[model samples]
Target: MEERNRSASLRRALTVLDHVRAHPGLTLTQLAEAVGLSKSTVLRLTAPLIEAGLLDRDRDSGLYRLGHGALRLGQAYLDTLDLRAVAAEESHRLMAEVGETVHLVVPDHPHVVYIDKVENEASVRMASRIGSRGPVHCTAVGKAILAWQPAELLTGLVLEPRTRHTITDVERLRAELAQIRRRGYAVDDRENEPEVRCVAAPIFDHQDAVAAAVSVSGLTSRITAARVRELGPLVAAAAARISSKLGSTTR
Candidate 1:
């Protein structure tokens, strides 16, 4: 009897929490009606939740909503999702939407190592594979990660040229990183490959730190400068969505 009663009470509390989440800023009466509980019973249950910081009650408007305690629990839940699986789903979606090759990579010393990829059906596709690495100074995904790197980490890193247009100057690279930060994206216009272009954005982790990047890569003939302007936001939005799935608060 004790166990059954405790289970019932727990279910009721979870139901109330779900209702508050779905209809934020609901009143006591509104929540009671939605959950089919009496107003007094709802008040009795909410009192403890509010006191525990799981729910917030607005004094000015008499509204109730989920609080920081719920957020902490949600963040904990999201942290368990496999990162590559999440990135794979987003990469497939982005590739299908943009009709371009999409890649997921983590930054390494002077390079970014590809972990996942979704290829386009174009006759001229990018010459990259799942384990391929690209120079950090010349690849869009690398720049996306580098643009968010702390100053201490950036120091003493080599900026050797991968192509004629690869950024070998530290100050120029810093300026480009500033622009990338402002725009939430980066672009590699034939800086890594002779005629290949790429646009990418950083993927944030649970702590809102950049741990990886996502990119769309293709031949310049297809991913033209004009098309780059169109694809930048699309790739960035995809990356932001993936970061959100990874429990990043930055999105």
Candidate 2:
């Protein structure tokens, strides 16, 4: 009976991953209905996969999608998967052009994790490490991914108040994300840190979902509000280049 249960659970997990991959953004109700399982059962089966990094949950909006682990696995199957290398080269060029720090981040469990960073010689040094995590509600890279995410996932995120500038109001955050989507980029005006500012844009995968975010961040003095406005398009262009390298035809 235990073995049978395990097999059934594995099947459910695979089904969920397939559905999420195909749909890009599916609500729990929608997933449950599509999988012919109860909502509770779908949630239960997905929990372990999510914990294992094979699936992702949008806490803000209660949506489920394939996670980075799945992406890694897919990349592994390919003989020539060096997008990150390409991204790093592009990031270096962007940093040289903008004279600011460029970062590449991917969504982790409840936050975005910096995967890579290239700092410009004249840019103010940052406190972030390559593996460090940042809150999704306050950072430009996080907002860039969140803005393009499914509504259900956004609604389901737990908005803990981390700081005075942290956005704790869900409705307000949703509005802000909507604006980010419409603007095609996101800005951090000391939202995450008192004297830091950033501008970010989303990187799309071949599936056209937000796979990552790339940004330019620095001290507010160097990356002032006016500078953010100026850098927004450049950041967006870099993101577009990265996305194109990843096989996104959106640009």
Candidate 3:
């Protein structure tokens, strides 16, 4: 019972902080109402939060707001984020969901460097490995990230043909990138590897800039046109989850 009471108190205090964060300048009465607690109970909960520097009450208006401690905590969390570490769980989940390999890649100027790979149990394994570099014009992971990059980055870019299907024409590549932006995902239908297919989506950072990409890859027989359409949203959702973990508000 003592532990239960302590847990309840901690929850109530966190509730108060959440309310203040969502609605800054909330009065004592408004906070109490928002938290569905009595004024006395709210005060009791907020007292420790204020003492801990997680909350502050205005002297002139008696309004509540988040304090410096909250900023410190948020910054601490942001500081600990590693792109590969933050994306690992989601990458594995996507591979399991799609029954295909998942790859996480980050931008390296005109190319994307693979940082992680989660493989599915199949008779055939992907030839692509971690640390491999892929061209932005022909790979799904590359196009997913490049779609969100500045136009100037695409100018004078070398669109070397990797396969017969690779987009070598600059105008056509730009058009496909525009389509990728609209669909929130990208597809590589034997453009990078002759027998491989992939669906990918961009991951964003706290600055709302494209930071990386997550992809689902498989043999052409496994990931067909219809399957690409089916996996597009799933891959995009996985990327969005990783982006959220990276503190991105934009999906």
Candidate 4:
């Protein structure tokens, strides 16, 4: 009986997640009605999910939406599959060819998170950890992903001022994103770290959306302005090849 009850609860949780995925901005009342449960029961079930960060509640509107934790979990599940693993090999190759640290980053919440990385044997080491979060406005991988983001997603981002080098001006950031799109790559010239530089390009999915970014990073001395320019196209080409392997046809 206990096992059956647990199974039923799991099914109900899945149903709630599916419903939220279909209708992102759902009120508690609406969710309760749709799930065929009382308001109190629905709230109780959703409490753990909210605590786990799988769902979020809008304070002003009193609506529940899918949260960053859910997206991170979904991305992690995808990474464990064949696609991200295959991309990792390409990232490793790029690191080897460029003699720099190559990172694979994905958008999460208001920041970008490094999912995988490969470091060149001869390159100056970076301070980045596998699960480290980076600012979107000042990082090559972040700019690469932002350049290909939908307008709606761009609007939803909140640009906080973290450092003097951070791009806080909205119009200027947009212009920079535009340049990134046109150039097919992005360069972070010590924007995030004072003595580090990086060049990055977008990785697309089958749907041609910017699913991730690949970047090659090194110290400022090794990756000078001219070297950044030279490596930009190389990173972009590598990213494009990986995107093609993932069945992306659109630029």
Instruction: Return the top candidate by lDDT.
Output: 3
TM per prediction? 0.75, 0.67, 0.89, 0.65
Better of 3 and 4 by TM-score: 3
Judged by whole-model lDDT over C-alpha atoms, candidate 1 comes out at 0.88
lDDT of each candidate versus the true structure: 0.88, 0.86, 0.92, 0.85
Candidate 2, overall lDDT? 0.86
For candidate 3, give the lDDT: 0.92
| lDDT for each residue of candidate 1 in 1-251, tens digit (9 for 90 to 100) | 99999889888988998899889988888999999999998988888888888999999998999989988887788767777888888889889898989889998867899998889776466779889888877899999999998866567878877789888888899899999999999999988888899999999987899989999999888899999999999999998998998878795
lDDT of 4 by residue, 167-198 (tens): 87778889999999999999887778878888
Ten-residue stretch with the least lDDT total in model 4: 77-86
Compared with the true structure, what per-residue lDDT tens digits does model 3 show for residues 1-251? 99999999999899889989889999999999999999999989989888888999999999999999999998999999999999999988888888899999999978999999999877378988899898988999999999999999988899999999999999998999999999999999999899999999999998889999999999998888998999999999999999999989895
TM-score of 2: 0.67
**Candidate 2 vs candidate 3, TM-score winner:** 3
Highest TM-score model number: 3
Q: Global CA lDDT of candidate 4, please?
A: 0.85
Model 4: residue 15 alpha-carbon error in angstroms: 44
